[model samples]
Target: MPRARLHDVAEWTADGHRYRAELSAYLPRPALATGGPVLGTDVDLPSSWWADLREALAATAAVATTRTTVRQQWIDRHFTRLLGIPAPAIAWTTGHGDLHFANLTGPPLVICDWEGWGRIPVGFDAGLLHAYSLLRAGTAARIRRELAHVLDTPTGRAGELVALAQLLQVTARGGHPDLAPHLARHAERLTAMPVP
Candidate 1:
């Protein structure tokens, strides 16, 4: 829906912000997953798929952290409030809101579950996808390639922040033991990044 609405606007004016704000208002909040579902139980996607997913997450993170009213401190506060746990000292960005492998389908694979979609950091989706991809090995290069392609595009850079932010938010909230170790690693990677 965010993409669809974004595409609907042809002119660049203050109205665009109004439209985006309206879209954010209309969008529903995401439901808490009781237990994080199996990350890649449904999809037979290749490891290379993580590249595109990572790019998208990063793009979103960049937009949210840099462009939105929300700041990293605010994001941490909200995350702590929402998850009932002290927020990890990590950067935040806009998120896909609810990103899981199941949200993706079809050839060229479209992502669904836009309830959590909003401003985030560049690595949000990348971290989530990386955590999920941990069960497999030798696919990181492919994922990196796709991300490089995205970073080369204008929107790609913008979306990167949002994606990373979302990735951090979701992993913190989801509470999957299976993912804990992977999350820790990705979180470390995110924390090490030089703020863009």
Candidate 2:
């Protein structure tokens, strides 16, 4: 499911020379799963799941550290730099910015929540989905496959970097109880991978 457009309007102000386009809001439908066992909310994810997540994280890190125009710099002058890569050119599409098991339900597994929807690089949503699936063992490959299928189109490939960017944001915000462990482990692995 993609993010729904709430409002879009263009405005002219000042002496008529200044113009602005404002896209108000967008979001997915409400969740049907409710309070029963939220997926991806566990801190101690399976090791196999971690392995698969590490692979994806490594790939994303490669792209982020290599291709981005914004270089990672320390908040204060530190001994390390956070490298950032540019998003690859691709067709833009509305997507459920946040996709997790908690947000899915029923037969088709409809995704909800559109607050994060916007123009992004390929595979952004799929990557997050794959990471969420990593909470359990034996699901990584399946999740990865599903992600690949969802993002296999040319437009998806071009937007892969956008997905990577979103992942990086999640990783950096280590306060989330559900994602803290995954992000910590991912950071370790990312630091270990050889920079291209």
Candidate 3:
């Protein structure tokens, strides 16, 4: 959670549209990935980085907020339809709704992009990261291993299915063709149902 202090903020109307701009402290570290949200290749990260990430996520989860990242209605509608399984009871907690390699940085470990932070299923962040890491078996495995406490429960599995459904939907729209089959297989393994 290497967040910078916001020094200033401004808002204005431009041609019937509202716009905003903010000045904040700069982060010196570069993001872990620059290409995209999905990590297509393995990255060498130190063990300490993993520990720091776990701590940051835990700290985030402890914060109080009224915002929501994923709603219950969407879960109800998509869980069974997209995952081919009944939606399990979800345990909600604060999370970084979009937790991919692209949003993370460092041996210092900075989590960037705060817009989507809100209440989500307990393991949503870890699940989202795992989904992004699917292309790299080793990295994917490491994520599961490192985040086991968050990702090895019923609610966690539900959260992961939610993430998979999202990625699969992206595929349905002709995005991430290379990642589609892997997502399908992972879904199959999770629910024991064939996914296309």
Whole-model Cα lDDT per candidate?
0.45, 0.43, 0.86
lDDT of 1 by residue, 87-115 (tens): 44443456665554445543344555554
Give the Å shift of residue 67 in candidate 3. 0.5
Clashing pairs in 3: none
After aligning candidate 3 to the native by TM-score, how far in Å is the CA of 8 from where it should be?
3.7
lDDT of candidate 3 over 78-139, digit per residue (tens): 77777777888888999999999999888688887776789998888998899888899999
Which candidate number has the best lDDT?
Answer: 3
Full-model lDDT, candidate 3: 0.86
Clashes of each: 46, 10, 0
Q: How far off is residue 181 in model 2, in Å?
A: 5.2
Measured by TM-score, how close is model 1 to the native structure? 0.45
lDDT score of residue 27 within candidate 2: 33
Candidate 1 lDDT at 156 equals: 44
Off by over 4 Å in 1: 1-71, 74-95, 138-141, 149-174, 189-196
